[model samples]
Target: MLDARGLVIVFGLALGASACGGDDSSSGGGTGGASGSGGAVGGSGGGATGGTSGAGGGTGGASGSGGAGGGSGTGGSAGSGGAPCFDAKRLWFEDFETGDYSRWTSKTYDKNWNNGFCHDNGFSTAQANSPTHSHRSEITCADTQSHRGYGGLQFAGDSVVPAYTNQGSGIDAPNGVVNTYWSWLEAPYAFQNGKWFSFWTVNNDCGWKDNVITLGLEDTSNKLTPAHIKNTGGTVTFAPNAPGFPMGKWVRTTIYINYHEGVMVTWQDGTKVFEATFSRPDNDICQWHWGAYASGDNDDVVLYEDDNSIWKLGQKWTNFDVEPYFGVTQAVCSP
Candidate 1:
């Protein structure tokens, strides 16, 4: 509990003396005016009249001015700060538990690994028919291959691999592929026109590898692509090479969309890295996906993702009773 209190003191002092002391009677034949003492009678033998003495100086008035009022002091309340508040009804996935699949979809090639291609069960695989699975593996680099890694569905876990086998895509072409790191975000269905929001992070290859994060806006007419779309204009790329960027570490990425403005801001750890606004309207509203595609087959290239979560802006976490999959609150500070 906290309390506040105020204290005040007032004081006043007078500066001048009162005018109450004055003589009135005269001695002999002379009369004296107000404040003067009468003198003794002149040399006459007769007894001289008594002179009145001036009244004593009036007492001086009291001393200095009134004092001022004092200010109040208050004690601040105690509580936790930076706790993340998420919408329980709107959560897509937590603790890698799949609630529904109709809301998400994925893109896969039948048998074509054109870039250092291999259907070698290492990269992409499905998690237990459930929306979430324990899928974790690294894509290693190779010398002759242009694109060394395979893209796959990532789930929640510190480090655990699902017990599924990866199907092969036999179109291995080293030169046609490039080396890069990226991730994917799958949604059961298309997001509403003005109600979709998503956030995630992508890990870079330390050196020589170009890592990027993409928000697949399947809706071609909606606005939100101008700030991210490159010359080819297919998908918006959040890259680490941008100027004033704090590169070489994990960076947090955010996407906010509505009618007025489609803004994208990326932060390194917790500090802002880059912000971009798109002039063109984005209309894509299909299932979203995040992953990597490279130019050469350098199997060593990889991307890491964690703390993947989403929420509608202005929504509070307490309104819903849904718990996080891991049994812990996913609410986190902006770090």
Candidate 2:
């Protein structure tokens, strides 16, 4: 579900922590069972360091509506087709139903970086993406520092995903790789500025760490800082972080790299919150890492990932706009 190695290269932000149990989630949208209780253990702050400043609280708008009470609700629209798929061959698929990390160990996405499963820090099937026997990937950060060795399950594309070099070339033109992280659980310690995690696309083929985005908390605002896509001439749209990004919910993010159109689209919870035209010449994508990374030490931070969360987006799905706001399973994608 993650390419942890690419995270280190991109933002030095580590992806980690236990399941978040997305509290305050509604029945139709956002993951449930996120009571923020039970197996929800607070990570040890490593007696060696002091506590973090933590995040400032954010408020959501009220749902009080002034409408015609007599009017009946309109029929809901039909949904998109197909379940989440990865790659043209579906070889990168992993639901973890077998309860193992064999898909990662079976073949390294790029051995030039690391090899085998980084089971030292470890990942297992503890959290459930769904109560009906569906499980999620609970990735633990290294007890020490940045887990560069092998903390992710990389899914290599036939050609780089989202075609890194050229905008209109390859799958990135129409079909880009999509990965969603159900931060269904987050320990209290994960609220610091040093908190960083890479969710999707990071170029492992070469060392172009520009558009490679990483999730983190902005020290000043204490909001989750979304990743930015960069071009050749030190160009980047320094946008503000989303108000309540990783606060114990499944934040669905989609990255659409359009070199031809000269635009890069970032969708959060199914909204086109950020868009930028790249001045760079070309773009190439290699892998997607669903694990953890850290700016400082791995500490006790541990992030959760749903086994069925990773997805492949057919070109048209990108234009769905906010259709996916209903959360993961309910949101439809083109086959």
Candidate 3:
């Protein structure tokens, strides 16, 4: 998002286009040598009386040229150019149900389900340590309840219950508001693991606030088992341009992580959003839990969720491509 200062710069550039000046004309030729300048001023030569230039017929005053067309006004710069398009392969979660866990290894830790406050039936809840919020509760899974059946990973308000009273602390809240969301795959996870991914959203007293989708990978390591972990954070805030984002409605969020040397680029809704490079190797030991962690009350929570599919890492785009075909045309008969 652009800050106030950037807006000022943009406005200044826009004003520069009007700086061109208008035109001015030089005085026309003096009324020719006043007919008496020469010796025989016979009748001032009628038409030539103004001067030897024959009065130049007043030159019709040069028709006042039409303002040079204002140089076409520069067209206002085309509105930031549309986002580039890229080919995407859809990876569904249902594929994992048939024992295709070869590409993905679910972090096999048990989540001690919470029986309090009526847990949403859709989420696989758990408790875990959050880097930013310290320890918090979280939820994970897709929202199958929606007609589109897209996946989503979420964190609940109760997870950060302790920090609720610690509001206004810059260390935890940048906007001075209490927020609960997803924990991204940090350093240790990215260095050792090959792929890390998640889908999440932010909710508060205002209802469904916005969405932030992420995906990353980690390498193998001595300190951890999985080797590496990485992910991306792409946020879609509440604004007019962001369509299909419903307040209190389930929006489908997805992420695909592409790992490159030192850099990982993540795509949300088929568009690239986050890119970062790592200085040290990041790897983890297990396939992390989705809902809640085994030991803490701070777990990731999700609502309006479903888990009908699973996809593996390292699968090529071709694995999910569906080719289009045209059948033979039928002939029509007329009376």
Error of 1 at 131 (Å): 17
Using lDDT, give the best candidate's number.
2
Each model's Cα RMSD:
44.3, 15.3, 36.6
- lDDT scores for all predictions? 0.20, 0.30, 0.16
Q: Regarding TM-score, does 1 or 3 come out ahead? A: 1
Question: After best superposition, candidate 3 residue 60: deviation in angstroms?
Answer: 81
Compute each candidate's TM-score over C-alphas.
Answer: 0.33, 0.50, 0.25
lDDT (Cα) of model 1:
0.20
lDDT string for model 2 (58-158, tens) is: 11001111011101111112324633422221113333333333433112222233332332222333443432122222233343333332223322233
Q: Model 2, stretches more than 4 Å misplaced?
A: 1-77, 80-92, 105-125, 131-145, 149-177, 190-195, 204-211, 220-224, 228-241, 259-262, 271-273, 279-281, 308-335
RMSD of 1: 44.3
* Cα lDDT, model 1, residue 94: 17
Q: Ranking by TM-score, best first?
A: 2, 1, 3
Q: How well is each residue in 1-335 modelled by candidate 1, as lDDT tens digits?
A: 00111000000000011110001111111111111110111110101000001000011000000001101111111112433433221122211122111111122211222331331212122321112221222233333221211222211211111211112121121111011111222223332232221121111111101212233121222111221223212233434543221112333333332212423443322223334433323222111123222212224322322223222233322211222211122332221
Q: Which residue runs of candidate 1 sit more than 4 Å off their true CA positions?
A: 1-91, 94-104, 107-134, 137-260, 297-299, 314-335
Lowest lDDT 10-residue stretch of candidate 2:
53-62
